[model samples]
Structures are given as C-alpha cells and as structure tokens.
Target: MTSPITTSSLPEELAPVPATAAPAHAVALVAEVQPFPIAVAGAELEQLAHRLIATRWPHRETAADQGPALDEIRALCDHWATDYDWRRAERFINETGSYRTEIDGMGVHFLHARSPEPDAMPLLLCHGWPGSILEFRHLVGPLTDPVAHGGRAEDAFDVVVPSMPGFGFSDQPVTTGWGASRVADAWIELMRRLGYHDWVAQGGDWGSSVVDAISRRNPAGLRGIHTNLPLVFPTEAEVRDATPDEQRMIAAAQRYRATLDGYAREQATRPQTIGYSLADSPAGLAAWIYTLFQDVTDSGGRPETVIDRDEILDDIMMYWLPNTGASSARLYWEAERDVSGAQVIGAVPAANPVPAGFSIFPGEAVQASRRWVERRYTTVLHYRQHERGGHFAALEQPAALTDDIRTTFRALR
Candidate 1:
C-alpha cells in the first residue's frame, strides 16, 4: 500500500502553507479603505437631546438591585442631557484615528493607530455587544506608543480597533447572516487589507468570540490570540470530577446564567422586539446597557464608581448615536443559533491550535480554570489571573490588559 505523502517528501501541493497565507474571506467586493473621520452632525446631537428630554419615566423598583435604580438612571440622564460632551468623544476619535472600508458592500469602521517604533507589532482589538470600538480607545496610547505611556518602545503595537458591523459607526447589515463566523472572516480581511502580514488579536465579550473564530480559521497572518474571557466549558466528566477551583468557576458561571443573563436571553431571542424600546428612547437604551456595566464591573453594584460616568455615557453614545440598539443586538440573535452549539458570548471560545494566551479577571462571571484553558488551546502561550477587573476588561482594567498583551505577544515576537 502506498503511504500517504510524508512531510519529509512532500510535493508542492502537499507543502506547508506559507505563514502569510491569505485568510478565507467570502466577500465579493473589497473597496479601498478610506479615512472616515467621524462627524455627528449638529442636527443629530439635537435630535438625541430631544429624545432624551422626551423620555417617559418609569416607576421606581421596590428592590434596589432589581435593575438600574430609577433615581440613578434619571441622574445619569440628567447629566447626559446637561453636562456630557459627545463632541469631545467625537473629536478624540476623529483626531486620534478613524477609517472605514467596504467589505461585502457593508461599511466596516475602525480606528488604526500606527506605532512610531520601527519594529512595532500589528494588533487587532475587537469589542462585543453594548460596546463600541470605544472600549479600546484607552488602549491606543499605551499599545501604539508604549514608550510615551511608560513602557518600552519594543512593546509598541500598530493597533487596529474595528467597530463590528451593526455597532458603533459601522453600517448596519442589510440582511441576515452577520454572525461570529462572518465577523471573523471580515476581521481577517481587515488585517490583510491594512497589509498586516503577521499579527495578533485581543478581545473581550463578543470580541473574544471573534478572536476565537479567527484562531479556528488559523489564517496565515494570525500569529497569536489573547482573550480576557476564555471558553472552557468543562466536560460533564470534568464537572462531575471537579477540583475546588474548578467548582468555583463552574458555580460562578451557573449563577450568572441563572440571574445576570436575562438581557442576553432577551437580546438573543428577540433583538427586534427589544430594539423597538432601545431605539426609540435614550433613557430606555441607557438603562438597558447600564444594567450590564453595573452587574459586570468590579464596582460592587456601582459601575460609575469604577468607570467614569462620562466614559460610560460615551460608550452608551456609541449605540444611541448610531441607533444601534437593535442592529447590534442582532449579533446576539445570530450567535444564539451559531458557530458552535456550546458558546455563551461572554463564556465560551473557539477551539483551535493557534498559539493562544488568556487573562482571567476575577469579577468576570464566565471564566475557565488554567487546565480547562490548556486543554482547549493546544499551543498555549500565556495564561494568568488578575486580582481586579470584570467582563469589560478593556474599559475596567486598561493598564493590566495592556501589560498582559505586551507580555503575551513578546514571546510570540
């Protein structure tokens, strides 16, 4: 019997693929990337002001933790209407960076920060639901210009933060099928379009899933991936034979799915239905998104205590300004019926052989033990647990996240 072609005697067809091999991209048309400096027309801001002012208030909840406190949201809205500056956020984004390209006829918006260092690494940052590229905004300075941010010049990265289609300033999808898998393809195409032949990616929330998807694709240019939330659902056996540490993680995830996941379920099953309330009322949208920030942050029920009120509002504006309350939720809708039958947007990850690293934040509801992570990521590069931070790592713990990214990729480089 003829032996299968051996690696030692491989012909051209059987030769190893090059490291820079193109990632699979199904899009039919890819247009030239253009400089898309964000500018929310003055009329748009006025319209938002009108919506915020016209909000119909809801009755107070008897229990404080039942949801966003009526007084809290009102106070937030009061400040949003009077003191918050959307123009400042707009100007920062415009001045620092902004770009958009048409992939499959859908406009993909991103912020590209080029490093001044000669041998800087290329990095892609992804964000998830209720989050815009805004999550990674703070990362621009330290990551792209590490020396200026109290880090070594060797750690500088050419960072690309993309607003997943239907979120932030990116155009909403006109049809169905914009799931994690498709977003992964688009991200790969994005890095390629920008001429990044070798690079790494980082993500949290939905961003984790995108990075997971890209890893599974094992595209040529993708050198490594780092995630704050790693998907390591212990097998039924692992659960049955759980260690003390493993049990704690499993229990934490169980508690989250039982109590804190109502919003996810609503978004997953009825994005359109929820979209109506979210799209029409600024107050409704803020409360909906705020519930997450409150529940997931390490702030002990007060997200504003941990994250700046203005920054929180800025994140909310990403959805409110673009009217993405409904559109962005569609990703959850697609994911519920998605890539792997076993993923929770904030819990699970794509299984792959790509060199992988993970940073577990203590307050993040969904997390895996080191063994679980090691089992899934065949080529584990780095893994560590942090004392603070939550699901919104980029926003809640930028410095730690930055340090972890630098450490993880240093080995790869």
Candidate 2:
C-alpha cells in the first residue's frame, strides 16, 4: 500500500505547503543566471508615436478646464510623440536582473534582485493602479546593497517586483478571484516556491489592499507587512469620537469619494464598458491615468512638481503597449462585489500576526491615523509621515522610499 506523505516527509520544495494540499503552488523561481533582456524597439515606439501624432483629438470647450486639461494633454502627447525613449527605459529595467515566470497558468514578469549579503531578508514589493514594476526600479540597487548606499549590509533585501495579474507580463486570469485576497495567496505561494520560508511584503494603492489580505490571512512564513496606503474600516464610536485632524481627514476622504472616485466606481462596476474606450486610444488611456497623477499631488500648480513627465509616461506606456487598460481595470470591477455590499468594512480586516509598518505620503487619499491602523494591524513598528511625496511614492521619492524599506525591515530583523 502507498504510504501517506507526512509534513516532515514533504519535499523541501514544499517546505511551506498550503493548509490544503489541493491548492498546489505550481510556479517555481528559476535560478538567475544573467539579467533578462526586454527590448522595446525604437521603431515600434516611433510607430506608436506616429499613431498619437496622427490621432484626431475630440473637441473640448475652450473655457472648460474640467477632466484632464486639454492643453496639458496635448503637450504631454507632443513630448511622448517626440522626446521619450522606450529603449532606455527597457535597458534600465533589464540591467536590474528582471525575469518572467509562469504562475497559476499566467506568465508573471518580475524583477528579482538578490542581495550580495547571504543573510539578507527576502521582500516582495507590489505596486498599485496607474503604476507598474517600474515604480521600484530605483529601489532595487539600494535595497539589495544597503551598505553601499550609506546603510548596513544587514538591511539588505532580496527584492521581487511582480506585475500584478492582467497588468503587465502576467497573463490575465479569465475567471474571477484575482482580487487582493487571491493575489495575496498567489504572492505567498510565489515566495514559498522561491524557497523563502519567511519574507516581507510591501505595497501601495491596490497593492496595499493585497498586502493587508496577506497579513490578515497570516500566511505561513510571512515575517511582516508594510504599506503606503492602509484602509481601516471605521466604527461608530471611532467616527463619533474623532479629533479635528481625524475629522478633517475624513472630510477629505468623503470629498474624494464624491469627485475623484468615479473612475474607481466605473472600474469596479462596469470595467468592460469603460475598457472599450481605453483599450483602443493611447491618448485616451494617457488621459485616464494622467488625471490621477494630477489630482493626487501636493504641487502648488504643476503636477510635474510631484512626478516627472518621463516617469509618468513610462507607467502610461505599460498600459498602452500591453493593452491591459481594460483587463487591469476589471480588478476594480471584481472588487465591487465586496465594496458595494453592506458589510461596512468592505473586506475583513486581516488578522495578521506579523509586524506591520506604514509610510504615509502627503498626497494619498487620507493618511490612516495610527489609532485607526492599530485596529487592523497586530503590530505597528514604524510609521513615518513624508513631507512631500504623493500617491506614486516609489517613483516620486525613491531614495526616501528605499530608506523606509530599509528602516522597516531592519526593525523586523
């Protein structure tokens, strides 16, 4: 008779097996031999530029400054059609030891930068809406070699930057369940498959939600969690017993819901309908993503004060070339099922036992007060309020972000 396999007898590859063996982790992290090449040929980019230049823009009211100022859009398109360099960006990404692996029947692309330090902690960093793996580009070098960047080698981290499912090289899931919760499971399996029994997770935007799910679920071997955005469901007493700053923050959040959340609402409810408009027109796609960058900045009058034009365009190009505008937006659509319900708390606050940290950016929706975040997180080791960075903190202030990552993980160590 065949003997039943016990946990001790399980292969090292399955060292951190799931609660149920039925949820097998299929993806494997192959050994990194050399930097993976990504070639966005100059000619192809030129062709895209030509299409933009030839596009017949729709008419807008001359006096109307509503919804992505026409002049700003035109200027941005002109620069993209003329000055931007996709090849250079591709080279930058390739130089960082990027790679692709198949997970859950999807081809997932990620940047895997191993630390020179043998004892370095492994960290999985995720990005959110209107962002990509590119956000963490500057972070790879500093994180993998902290000593070289004015920090101790013990602060080093082996970083993994995966493009969320349906966002980049990762194949779009035909079915549902690729939401934050499912994505968290995929991330845990990814780390386990990579032979990391313990690791850290960090994210912003939709990534924050995914990180929250990972912590709440308390996946085996998760050491700690960090996020730029932490959504805490408020209680009646909390709302009733709010301070002036808390009340002001709540008001700002309410205003955001009223005005700025339309895209989210549509994405959450009718992504397919909205996707049709975004999938075809590159300019349309740029406008949609660009609007967010504009709305969520602390710049006095110019969005450029917060985000670089080329950097913003780089993120826009990911959506443009991958044709993921529609597919990626569907994540919001799938999330609506829970967000629209009367549960009040959206999804359950993760009951994660691991230590958690927060890096509060100035332009984020509303910085979740420490008291509020404490309700959901078991341990809050580090909380820093940035003076200037905005929604896209990784791209806007990479050096500062790298420092935060180092400081937070250093505490966990």
> Of the candidates shown, which would achieve the greatest lDDT relative to the real structure?
1
Tens-digit lDDT track of model 2 for 186-205: 78877876788889999998
Clashes (N, CA, C under 3 Å) per candidate = 1, 4
**Pairs with backbone N, CA or C atoms under 3 Å apart (clashes), candidate 1:** 231-349
Where is model 2 poorest over a 10-residue stretch in terms of lDDT? 1-10
CA displacement after TM-score superposition, residue 77 of candidate 1 (Å): 0.4
Which ranges in model 1 have alpha carbons more than 4 Å from their true place? 1-31, 339-351
lDDT by residue for model 1 over 320-392, one digit each (tens)?
Answer: 8767899899998988677553354334344578898899987898888888887677788888889899988
TM-score for each of the candidates: 0.89, 0.87
Model 2 collision count:
4
The number of the candidate with the highest TM-score is: 1
